[model samples]
Target: MQNQGLLKELIQSLCCLPGVGPKSAQRMAFHLLQRNRDGGMQLSKMLARAVNEIGHCRECRTLTETELCEVCANPLRDAETLCVVESPADVWVIDQATTFKGKYFVLHGRLSPLDGIGPDQLGFELLEQRMATGQIKELILATNSTVEGQATAHFIGEVAGKFNIRATRIAHGVPMGGELEFIDSGTLAHAFNGRREF
Candidate 1:
């Protein structure tokens, strides 16, 4: 609590970031100010650059500096399949597993009635448009296994039949409440292989 107003403000702002509570924010602020002044400057610069340069990918809604994410732009990826995810982070996690080789369609969020997030908020219209292209044969719903994630996937599956696109959900080899990023490579691969019709 004994710090300049600017330092206090920085700690308060840092606390607003996801997973950074007050205690962690305070420790981070102290470390940046006391021992890592140069690193702090670098962090600030990088954060500014990322904030300014990054935008949603046009195709998948993934975070990208360009119109399309690298995954969508890659030629070797399977064009006939589209893996739907909740966020750009999921794309990164799946990419690390190296189990999927298809293009992605990021929902950017799930339908959480408690949070006021609905189908429209998750870009269901864009998904419909992508399916309209008729190139994608499979629509894999790779959302988490949380209650909200399940609800979102179910809703997507309901609408997918209209387009006649084969809709599937990644198997629940992933633990309940476990995010795709935390699952091991083997589990992720198993989940991908064991995917079932949604």
Candidate 2:
């Protein structure tokens, strides 16, 4: 079945969102047109505003409307210990999960040379500059457990070592309450390597 021009355009645009396929986009378009026009309009306006105004924080590289993010602006946060993450979303997760008191540095992406992403693309230069300031005493690498993430963490660790700053990777292992049988080999290995006396 062929949709009218505007409806088709709307569905197509919705499909641009990650994990949204044509059918889901069509359902969303229909839902917006038939049941929730007000909500849809609000979403559209907010999307436009965010797209136009939101930008990376200069210090941490997280999304923000101003030069620095709220975390970077707050004076009470621990400036001597920085948590390095793969993206802004990780920052939010860490904030929600732990009682961590440090500032953050968002890489925005992991190292992927095949896709041409490298230190420059991941904002390593800015990170180095921050390290050179002698304000950060330690770096906590919270990058993902993927190959690229590990490689990125190693690269950052080497860079931190050059500046005489300590760096550590977040522990990867079987999650709390997870059975050993269900855990992957890599995670099990990491768990063994990161093990400490109980």
Angstrom error of the Cα, residue 62, model 1: value is 0.8
How close is each model in CA RMSD to the real structure?
Answer: 6.0, 1.2
lDDT of 2 at 184: 88
Write candidate 1's Cα lDDT for 114-197 as tens digits. 888887888888999989889989989999978888888898887888888999988678777999999998789978998778
In model 1, where do residues sit more than 4 Å from their true spots?
A: 1-3, 173-198
Kindly report which residue stretches of model 2 are placed more than 4 angstroms away from their true locations once superposed: none
User: What overall lDDT, based on C-alpha atoms, would model 1 receive against the true structure?
Assistant: 0.89
lDDT of 2 by residue, 1-198 (tens): 665899999999999999999999999999999999999999999999999999999999999999999999999999999999999999999999999999999998999999999899999889999999999999999999899999999999999999999999888778999999999888899899988999
**Clashes per prediction?**
0, 0
lDDT (0-100) at residue 89 of candidate 2? Answer: 95
